[model samples]
Target chain A: EAGVAQSPRYKIIEKRQSVAFWCNPISGHATLYWYQQILGQGPKLLIQFQNNGVVDDSQLPKDRFSAERLKGVDSTLKIQPAKLEDSAVYLCASELSGANVLTFGAGSRLTVL
Target chain B: AQSVAQPEDQVNVAEGNPLTVKCTYSVSGNPYLFWYVQYPNRGLQFLLKYITGDNLVKGSYGFEAEFNKSQTSFHLKKPSALVSDSALYFCAVRAAPGGRRALTFGSGTRLQVQP
Candidate 1:
């Protein structure tokens, strides 16, 4: 019955620095997702995973961003050489199966200087 | 490509009055529509969804949305607004073509309810 959990609710880093965000989804959930929400904008899908396998990541910035759900229960999203444009809130969500409703975490707000 | 549009950037309504936030979508085939709400500094929460049923769908927090296939619109509505209803609302859609499940979201609409 626990909700999705995320670590480091807020983060600050300099441009070109690296940052990582972690997410622990609801127990028994089979699908997980990562999204980025810029100020005044809706959350954009970054990646999605069904269990330990990726379902979609077409929108992700392959050159700078990467994510993994090794055991399928927890996930980590990383951004290397962060840019000012990368300043946004990163949200983590989980669902019971494909196309099911999502339950989200508080999200990690990143500020890149 | 599937996409959603929220025409209004913000809407202000007095408490106890009716409220509406407009949204339109573009997709290839039948669409799975959704509405979500976000509090400041928080993640998005599902309000309701329209898959297949009546044109009017009711959701949490006394909210409802009318799905119009002819207009390709799904506008969020509430008969009586409350101050606690103030938040950012987003409309989203997913095309059923090829069985893709990813959602395309609108920029968002900010709702302000005055007492």
Candidate 2:
């Protein structure tokens, strides 16, 4: 089985600029997640989707960060007016519904100047 | 709310020596504990998890973790450390069987194994 796929392995942008990262989850997986990992810290859940409907987005900064998993397959995370604090690695993971383990993508590293 | 703690920022051990990475967690309900390893510029790889059954769970890459309910801890252990095992280890927890099921991860502990 193929692992989760992410695009633009790296990205750099000035503060207040906009950026978007894409993710393709493993085949047949029904649950998808987006996490933000800051330097020297662990990954923090940004949003979660069960199929195409959102299950959680409590931690996502709705004012700047938004994510959508359309058609219940691929996902896109966008950060508009990116802030310095937004510079971090964005990871996408997927797992079968009711499964305990999650398979992750290599991740997209973003640098906000 | 669910949370995890990795008291040590880093752990150093010589190759072929026993190694341990401590992790403690708190959750509102029964806990689902997990350990993940992350290499440079890569995503986190599942190491092991404690869902139920045995208190000790074995996982990929010769790693294991003991789930202590009373202590609220799940510590990763390897009998003999390998240089290749050097990486960032993260402990994560989530409440069992309810809610959103999103994991809350610790800050992470970097393990350095020297030959």
Candidate 3:
């Protein structure tokens, strides 16, 4: 019963540069999600995936942010040409069932200069 | 249109004393409410949830939340606070049973427990 896994506990990027974060949800979990948590703010949903297909990504910045869960297992969230405001923590979560509480990863902290 | 609000940005309490963190929400139909605790540099951990049945739902770490339908509020509570209870608390909500899967979270309330 391992928890959701995420990589690169911390990252630093310059404005206009690109950065990517990865996530591995718990085994047997059917849903995966990516959320952005800015300092002093709640985590905002960026994208959600049910299996290998996307369930919702309406809040995602299409022009700069993109995410995908290939084969319905691993996920990657990318931000192209990052902005200073993009400095925040990226969290990955998994849900065994939509009716249950989510299990979250440690998160990847991004500091954009 | 589901949303949660944590009016207080921070709350302070002394060890061995009771503690309460307030939260309110708005959503259509039945609401699935939840409380989560986040330690610094870590992700959120589920504390409790209110789906149905009892209005007072207990959760991990000696935490509990009372769900009031009329008030549309789910406030976290602990009978006796501990210094380890200090952390960031978030209130979240979503439509229960056959609704959006995404959770709407509050800005969060920082709990500081003084020993």
Candidate 4:
């Protein structure tokens, strides 16, 4: 069984520039999530998708961040006009419906200079 | 609203010694709690979860957590520590009743087991 897969393990961008991170969850997983982990902090859920339909995005900054799951399999998180504080690791996790176990990806670390 | 707290920023223990990492949570009604460990430059690995029935739950890597409803705490423990066990540990809780399934996590605690 393969774990969740994420791409571009590392990224560096300038402030105000736009950046995007990609995530491909485990096959057959019904729930996908995007999280932001700042240094010394636990990952915070940025958004969640249940089969291509957003389940939660209350913490997402609408003005600068957006995410979507295509066909409920792969997902992408984008940040436009990035801020220095946005520098963090973007983690992707997936779980089956009604299951509590969550499988995570290695994450993409973003450095905004 | 749901939240978890790891009061300690770091915990140190010698190899072969018993270890404990503290965690507390705040949520309305029943709480679904979890523990995850992250090694350097690695994604979080699920350690264990407490949904119902048992206050003591054992998980991967010889880890266990005891859910104390009265104290609203779930502390991770291991009988014998190993150098390889050094990592960042996070505690998380599911959202409130009828809310999204997204988890709210603690700031994280770094555990260092010395050899």
lDDT of 3 by residue, A69-103 (tens): 88999999999989999999999999886557888
Residue pairs in candidate 2 whose N, alpha carbon or C atoms collide under 3 angstroms: none
How well is each residue in B1-115 modelled by candidate 4, as lDDT tens digits? Answer: 7889999999999999999999999987899999999999999999999988889999999999999999999999999999999999999998434235788899999999999
Across B1-115, the per-residue lDDT of candidate 2 in tens digits comes to 8889999999999999999999999999799999999999899999998888999999998999999999999999999999999999999998987335988899999999999
TM-score of chain A of each: 0.97, 0.98, 0.97, 0.97
Tens digits of per-residue lDDT for model 4, A1-113:
98999989999999999999999999999899999999988899999999999988999999999999979899999999999999999999999877787899999999999
Best by DockQ: 2
Write down the worst ten-residue block by lDDT for model 1 chain B.
B95-104
RMSD of each: 1.4, 1.0, 1.0, 1.4
lDDT of 4 at A38: 96
What would the per-residue lDDT of candidate 3 be over residues B31-94, giving only the tens digit for each residue? 9999999998788999889989999999998999999999999999999999999999999998
Interface RMSD of candidate number 4: 2.1
Distance (Å) between predicted and true CA of A27, model 4?
A: 0.8
Sequence-dependent TM-score of model 4: 0.97
Q: Indicate the worst ten consecutive residues by lDDT in candidate 1 chain A.
A: A94-103
Docking class of 1: medium
List the candidate 1 regions with Cα displacement exceeding 4 Å.
B97-100
Q: Report lDDT (CA) for all predictions.
A: 0.92, 0.94, 0.92, 0.92
Error of 3 at A86 (Å): 0.5
Candidate 3's displacement at residue A40, Å, is 0.5
Native-to-model Cα distance after best TM-score fit, residue A35 in candidate 4, in Å: 0.4
